[model samples]
Target: MPSDARSTDGSDPLDLSGGERFGVWRAARARRRREREEVRRFTAVSRRRRITWIASVGGVLTLAVACIAAAYTPVMAVREIHVEGARLVSSDLIVRDLDGELGTPLPLVDRSAIKAALVKYPLIQSYSVESRPPSTLVVRIVERRPVGVITDGDAFDLVDVAGVVLTSSPRRPDGYPLITFEGGSGSSGFAAAAAVVRSLPTEVLATVDEVTASTVDDVTLTLADSGAVVAWGSSEDSAAKAVALQTLMAAYPPDAVARYDVSSPESVVVDPR
Candidate 1:
């Protein structure tokens, strides 16, 4: 209104005198807003990290529970039992004995029960059990082989090299040599005879008629076809003895020799009938 006089309309006289002060206030407010925005971003990032960690832990727990539950459910139960490598032993009997495992979970199959049931069969020397997931159990058996037979009055006891009685028959079974030794099954004589029998080749063993031993070093045999006697010294050097006997038998047929002395296989002594 008048020269050098302030207006009454609350204007700053259109002047730049307070511009620097207002600029300071505006910069401070902008800085405060920027700090608040940074804090909010940091909080959001931490929250997302916590949510991710919780989700990962929950997933692991859920998977572990699912696996454990599946192990005990019918999905993992045994539905079939199979027997393999059973020759002298009955496969059906072994399968029947292991029937208790059926319907049981594979992971929970009673191994003690299987062992107890398998021990009933003496012919089974060793066995292994395997599980096929989602339903099958396999049992493999190894049976003892009889090397000779012993006379037990009216019955004949088939025995293996270890002197274990495999079975008994009312009548004399063919194809096995008759064993006779003084000291019941534990004598050195029996051991020597059993070793000699075990060392015999498949072809040579088939022709053995009888085995007799009163002492360890006097194990002897008689041929079935020719009735020729074989003087086997002991279990020592049995492989050589077998080879010598087989060679001598080939050179001089059993029909032509009355006795074959393989006690010293290096120099065989053949006596003519």
Candidate 2:
């Protein structure tokens, strides 16, 4: 068919195509439309990926800043201190001494400072510290126990097994026996006396009055009421010796005997006063 020439409504004939030319033009237009659609699809995907990346990086940075601020803020700092397990050392004193930790972040409190402050207190044997998040601190204390007292003139110095003096008084305090040794505290006599005194049974210990040691081999205990001297020998075999003394005392009352010798533990003897 020839290119149609026609007039509709008295207009000029419309230009129209058929055959190869028309097919070529139609294919070109479709290709152009597909290319534009591809470009639009690619642009939308790239834009979405960029937005997601920006949001992820911004979120991570925000979290990092928040963590740093919380770590240093006063809201997480120490405001109060509590002391536990304290007996000889006052709990209030411990809390007051640790006041330097106040206003410090809970995670940043100095352990060395705490130890330094507690070192000045002689009664504290050991201690531990804890943080109760947001605003509280806790300190636990262990105190030394007095084993006996050593007398110098009119003063009585209470001492532990290690010979560290805990306190001193002018008058004798009850429930503690007197410790008398030839050498102050450096000698084997003092060590032996301490070991022997600590080894005595509870019942036998209450009846005892004084612990005396001239040498490691000559430790003695004088009964408080009867003045009966117990020859307690060395610290060795002390448990056995204590048992023997109790058995002998049962057989022969301490008040009736002047001295009870149980240094050998297995063999015992008593002399009448």
Candidate 3:
């Protein structure tokens, strides 16, 4: 027999047994198990990072809402009130006028309530209230002007150009005209009488003693310089009548015209006693 063909199990090169093969398989299986464990660990770490990111965003959103709420709350209340454009009016009183709304939210403050309160004071003709955030309140006022003095019982009241009673005074004003009217008449009649007096010529108006609005059908003027009476039937044709009276006074002496009737616009009736 040839030496190469002879059977020699003991001399076989690189021969592996069943136990060795099983050992190699076991080693590979161990490596795959370790790789799977590593992959699971990485996945767990990534999931924890995603959870942390979501929590951070939610925390930021909640903080922003809280900050906004704090800004508009009482922490940012109005600290000062600035009063402007008020003449012949006490700023303290005007501030007192807004006292009812003090400490109120500027955004929630009612303008109508402030206006109604201000209107209660006859001197405040018009007013404006402004607000600035994080602490400022501004106010402006316009006061009414006195046109004449009105007698209401023992006290005298100041009247505006529209004949609206403004305020009462202990003593009468020196330069303003005096007005007298019958109590119980409508305000329209008194308003008309005031309008007519304002429409009179300056020279004639300066000499007027008292303007009486006793009846709608008749209006009377008493002269201050001479204590003479001028009968004006009504407020109708008042401007024309005033002009006619002016011309008559210029042409003829006031003494000659005792009772001047300027009720008619085109003609004049004079009665001299």
Candidate 4:
């Protein structure tokens, strides 16, 4: 009989002995390992690219924030301060108080602080402040106007309609009427006196010299030239009082009319000259 081994032919899956098959398997395994190593290298390169991208974006954001912060920091002098509707107050004084922020960040100006400082000035009635982006500060003010004169000892103080004292003059004012009160204390009587003046006719008010109020019910008016006294008595029926005075004066010219009493809105009494 022939040898039991079969003849190796080209038709066989592989023309190799057992040792050759083992060698081929080892070679295939090595190739697969090399390919896996190449894939791992590609993955590592991709992860490195992603990290670099994130770092670059973070760096840009930080730089932007730093630039913005630096820009807002006060590095320049105050360029402009616009003041509007100012009459009684001096713009220089208001600017002086704001000088505290000369080197401070304008974008970060404290609104409350500025307002508190400005309101301290007695002349300023109401004020508003604003900032121009990156540089300027604007202050707007409404000042008190002198409405009447307040009597204090030998001196007289100019006051606003709100009874706030503004300025004092050595003598009585030429335009406004002098206001007097009882107990020699004339501070609180300013508002009441002003109310009486405002309620009177414009023509009558123009000729007023002094306004005396001893009590709530007694309000006396002294004329400018003749020094005539008109008993006004309280602030009620002011329009009617003005009309009665006009009618009385029409009937009897003011040259001879000494005292005109209009305390009662319905009646008019003309005292003998």
Of the candidates shown, which would achieve the greatest lDDT relative to the real structure? Answer: 1
15-50 per-residue lDDT for model 1 (tens digits): 656787799789999999999999999999999999
In terms of lDDT, the poorest run of 10 residues in model 2 is 8-17
Ranking of candidates on TM-score, top first: 1, 2, 4, 3
Where model 2 places Cα greater than 4 Å from the true spot, the runs are: 1-71, 247-253
lDDT of 2 by residue, 1-273 (tens): 796455656555444456767888989999999999999999999999999999999999999999778867999899899999888778988888889999999889999999999998877788899988768898888898777888878999888788878888998878888999987876787789889888888888888889999989999999999999999888999989988998998899988999999998878888998
Model 4 — which ten-residue stretch has the worst lDDT? 183-192
Per-residue CA lDDT of model 4 for 1-273, tens digit only, reads 875454465255546898999999999999999999999999999999999999999999999999777757665334666677777687888887777766556666677878878878878888887776556788889887666787776788887777677877788777888877665334445555667787766677788889888776788888888777888887777778778876776787666778889899687788868
How do all models score by TM-score? 0.77, 0.69, 0.53, 0.60
For 1-273, candidate 3 gives per-residue lDDT tens digits of 656743476455546799998998999999999999999999999999999999999999999998768556885565677788777677888787677666766766778888777777777788778887766778888888766788777878888866667778788877667877765223756765677787788888887777877776588887776666778878888889899878877776566667777888687877775
Candidate 1 colliding pairs: none
Better of 3 and 4 by TM-score: 4
What candidate 4 gets wrong by more than 4 Å, as runs, is: 1-78, 102-105, 132-134, 183-190, 201-203, 239-253, 269-272
Index of the highest-TM-score prediction? 1
In every candidate, how many clashes are there?
0, 0, 0, 0
